[model samples]
Target: MPVYHSGFHSYVETEALNGALPKEQNSPQHPNLGLFAEQVNNSAFTAPRSENFKAWQYRIRPSVLHCSEPELITQHLIRDIHHKDSVLTPPTQMRWNAREITEEKVDVISSLVTMVYNSVAAVHLYAANSSMDKSYFYSADGDWLYVLEEGALRFKTEMGIIEASVGEIVVIPRGIRYQIELLEDVARGYICESQQAFYLPERGPIGANGLAEERHFLAPDASFENKEGDFSLYAKFQGQLWKMKIPYSPLDVVAWHGNLYPYKYNLKLFSPVNAVLKDHSDPSIFTVLSAPSLSKGTANIDFVIFPPRWVVAEGTFRPPYYHRNIMSEFMGLIQGQYDAKEEGFLKGCSSLHNPMSAHGPDMDVYTKASNEELKPVRYKDTLAFMFESKEPWQVTNFALNSVLRQKDYLTCWQSLETSFKEVVVEK
Candidate 1:
């Protein structure tokens, strides 16, 4: 199969060095996936990259750096992937009042997820009547950001409605209370949530090439429209629950501009990094936005993508083959069915494969790909994404117990009735 495994070393390798050297761990730009960087930069918020609290935004921008050399930034990230892993003093606890509402309550998925990965972890939730319930949560210890991956959503703030869809982003200041509404059948695509605050990926080599160029990340232009009314705001106070009543909508932004904004970068706008010559490159080559968790250390999380594009393989398995990992991978389909698995995982459907768990296409996919005639296939219909986290995931009780969830997803991987010989090649 044409598996685009990351060429970079895993975080585990680099973190070992953080404690030994400790000198080079001062910035977020370390190339390797740094895990302890957040611990070192915990005091960043005191500097307040922005004064007071104001909304920042970015929109459907694509990288324009393809023609230029990428090895510069790529090498930096790859080298940094081998930093030291020192445990932080301790992370401040951030919680929200997320309770099971229905007989089967949706376990509010809180408790900061990723540490900011080289890969972008984005979720486009397709929920019905599911209000991401009024909850207050924040990384008091670090700045956090959220971007709408796709579809429409209403950010339910204490003030009022902050609406967005594909190519839109919302930067909820740290220690903020926010909820969401799926105005559309499914609200989708969440990005840049983790210990490492999401920032615009540096365009070191791109310089003027325009990859994720600033102009494309359109900030919110609406004026601060004010509203007054009774509203209830819930806060995650010291890992406990607390509630208070407020009298207005906080999203009444008339106009604003700042780097600390929420914006979306359309995947299509991505100046896709493709191979000039034939050979598979790591999917990091497709990274739209990368947040480095490791400051003085290595990366905590990586948000990368396998966007829709042409598939070129003469005799290789064009789609992803089956595999598993130690990291938790939460995957979602963006539009149509993926080239690998034409069935299941509908556009709005999501699948969670925890650490060390086996995943990848089911048995049927293997059978089909092995014998199917080779054709220059273009993965034109869909976008298959992943939210890979360094921290092991705690399958929410809801996820663990939802009927909508397929407990027997294992059936997808049932062993094939027959087997084929492995293709061995001589060096």
Candidate 2:
């Protein structure tokens, strides 16, 4: 799927209601700052403050984040809210909280982001299906990557529904409402909470030559709607949760026009290439979606993978095509096995490859692919992905505190050796 870097609207949350001192109220004591503050005394807020009335002006407002997240928004928000008057969790009971944060360090990582949260984060994912419920599709405020490791999901969102397989992935951004129906007797996947929005992998000198392509991304065909029903919606606002009852299907926007909207693409759509000469190419060739960073033309994180592709670089040890990156990369495997980590890495497990930290397929896979025949070979059954980031992702409690995580992943490469004799060495 084509991915692009995205960020918060900075103003979407605060600008609309801030009662800043407006210029109209500016009388030497105060000056109106923005639109919301401009209407200060207009009743939407309290009374407008005049520029000249600084010292005599106002009483301090309480903390906005102080109340349960849901209450904070509902008290002032006026929009098409999905109210959950049915079997929905309460507003204050959404997911775990980020009480105290701790960061982890690794070497040779991709610019990709791979984060695991234990008792305090919400686990989520994204998927593209052919036949499922439209109301099952939803969005969120942060990045939610779903790892399909166990069964299949007859998933649905605004984009439509399909049967998602075990190796597939599904992403749901904050604020969108979606639901899931199991096509199998059981449905399970890894829920990756990307506090950072996933974006398009950055284009360096290679430019658009690699990574996810925009045209590959598919959006909902038409705004599907439930025209005349009073249904309940489970809205997870801020961290607080609440239910909103509306007269129509929440997904009925007809057509949306914004980079902020959600879309799903299968990694199976990826088109990869190997070299005809010696030396392997970059892992970025496997990029799916990327979220850009605050830096000028840099990525916050790039979702790359080590999916099955040709190992055609002639004369060079072909696996991974080895090297370091300015971007940190985190890699994970699904199904079969990854050549780079044939011995240690396993399904449902992960590894961190930091910026400048050099990594490649294990010495074994590197040597075998290098020495093998040069004829075109199609690698199947292997599925690996990377989460590259411009910044080092702070390892959350989920990654560190969970029994579901592997602490030994840091030492995964301890047994790699340099004894492959068949593959030709690069000059």
Candidate 3:
């Protein structure tokens, strides 16, 4: 069956087969096919906002059947910024080359490296060599946004199956049971888990035609697994991983219908709105998804992109201007190069500039853009993105001490000569 494209707030009803869903009512006194009705609420029942998301499902077995005594596991995924061995360093631009798999047979959950955490969200770097078998993981902490930098990952969730590759992102709502199986030998990517719901930013004057169209966002159709085996349901709650043993597979949703289901979007489909006359537009114009914080105008986490686009502005600085931002920026390149940095920023590589951190174009890019002809130039073969947050990220010890980190990252702008002019522009 073809996948449906419904707006985030609109109702989307789907079933594995016809008549599986109850007619005229969401929760029926007797569900069809001897199924049990379950509601997955992503927001409070009486939330005033119309964007409040929730879904209902008629499954083969109630989720209560999968419940058991949970035992604490030794997976310490939370990065303590104030810890004695924390990698919290002075504010400076940091970059790392694509990391290598140091160990063999690393699974997705185990490969997670919690880079930073704050009240709103947490940033994580993940690289896995093997697929998780008979193991499913979900977080009671927050919803997850997965940006695949390398490798293909197929996620089998209670709702359905969704596959994500490089240059694509898959969002798994909080508390949704899902397990990832890698299609490639090794998978590397970035993940952001936040307490807030990621939504499309208001188009305002730009209207709703440009940027990421909600119709292009693909949600999986009704699909399920009826496997009977020794399975485990792993939950990450309160910054710790807990495992609950179950006899049968917990992914037995025979039929489901909901707007809160997981979905994936391709970055290439983003219609970028760029400058036509003067200076470069703010990166917020390229934001695919944004999680708004309590503070108005500031985002908890804005998933913005630097997609391949044309540079056509005349008599203006073509590259990003040097400035300090109030938001913390965590950038990762999915493929090709970032315009601000001519080198070192490669696919699967990442860079970070904390809140109010001084950062801009590299010396080489700055010099080239200053002298290069100002014409309509199309920047091709590049897809770089950032998880910009309102709060600063507490760097993890592993990221601080990783061999992939560039030791000479601070020297990128050393060649920028001081061009201070003694005579100011006279009126």
Candidate 4:
């Protein structure tokens, strides 16, 4: 197991070698141990002090040495929000079964399939069997949020290494070189690439605690590997794949001190907040992270999770209520069953509800919650998450034509019949 330091966006100063970091000042004329000093800025220099993100890395070789003549590569499955192959359809509910793992050797990069996207974010699904070998990848477009559903994965990043399994999530900052290695025979998951950076949601009246505590988010300690061989570095830039040959491993940072690095959080550790007395609170209470837009409360993208929690609301329908909203939602199950649907929605399944497209508990779930006793029930063994955006999502051509799509998804609510009856009272 790899060691990790806890705290979200907290400044971390770690070194694999003693005296590897400079004593004072960020960049010295000569860094300690003869290491090269480089600074990576995630935000503008004029950004607010509280929002500024940057890191100082002391490495064996400067990153400029990794540059080479790039060659264009063809990757039809991976797409951006502006891809011409995407399709826009009328507002409708959609659902899809989990993608099957490939039988042939495939890595995380080759298995990525874009499902839906907008100007704010792109949602993708991946199923792969082989680990990345002598190759690394980075994205110049957006930060990656990985929601692991099936197997374990080891991410070797420029900062350090992080191992994550099902019921966990990992976020890699944009422009960070990393390689994904399968810890199991097969791996399946969902990824949300957001143009904006992710930040913890405000707590408001919930006080200073509850809902994804900052101390639970873990970042890896400093580690490095010095090896020379024929290797390739792939980059996702301008909606296309580019490759360059390199002679050595990119994970050569001996020391780093900064707030901009990859991190991981376990879903089971999320402290969920919900209604305890009479009604269901808005789903915003479940949000783990949000990328804010120019508009005050609206987010470019919100990552929310529905984990195991207690249900104690009285005189109210326990499952989610039927309604419509301005934000679009793309949801996936990481494990077990979601409470909103008694059937059909299974582990690893995905569903989408565009803006103003009404979605709620299915017929069976509604009937059961309405008639069953309202005792204090504890939901267990379930994990589901959603990637919500203010902008509506457009389905990709490949997702629309996939056989796993549920064509009869609308029929799940067709059986809902009117139960209203008028009564007269004597005046």
Candidate with top TM-score is 4
Candidate 4: C-alpha RMSD after superposition? 1.4
Clash totals for all candidate models: 59, 97, 0, 0
Lowest summed-lDDT stretch of 10 residues in model 3?
A: 78-87
Where is model 2 poorest over a 10-residue stretch in terms of lDDT? 34-43
lDDT of 4 by residue, 302-394 (tens): 999989999999999889899999999999999888999868889889999999999998888888988999999999978889999999988
Give the lDDT of residue 174 in candidate 2.
58
How high is the CA lDDT of each candidate model?
Answer: 0.42, 0.45, 0.84, 0.91
Task: Give all TM-scores, in the order shown.
Answer: 0.60, 0.57, 0.94, 0.97
Winner by TM-score between candidate 2 and candidate 1: 1
Q: Give a tens-digit lDDT track for model 2, residues 376-411.
A: 566777986665666543343334454545545434
**True lDDT of residue 408, candidate 1:** 54
Per-residue CA lDDT of model 1 for 1-427, tens digit only, reads 1111111111111111223222343323432322222111222456554222332211111111122221111111100112212322111111111111243333223322222222223222322335554332332323334444444766543222356666444545445334666666433444434534554455455455533444444332232224455544444322233345554543332222223333334555555555433445444455455445545322345555566676666666655655566555656556667655666666545666656666566667777877888776676766666656665444333333445565555565567566568989999
lDDT of 3 by residue, 24-104 (tens): 788899999888899998998887656678888888887887657999887555553222243456688888887777567
RMSD of each: 16.3, 14.5, 2.2, 1.4
Residue 221 of model 2 has an lDDT of 27
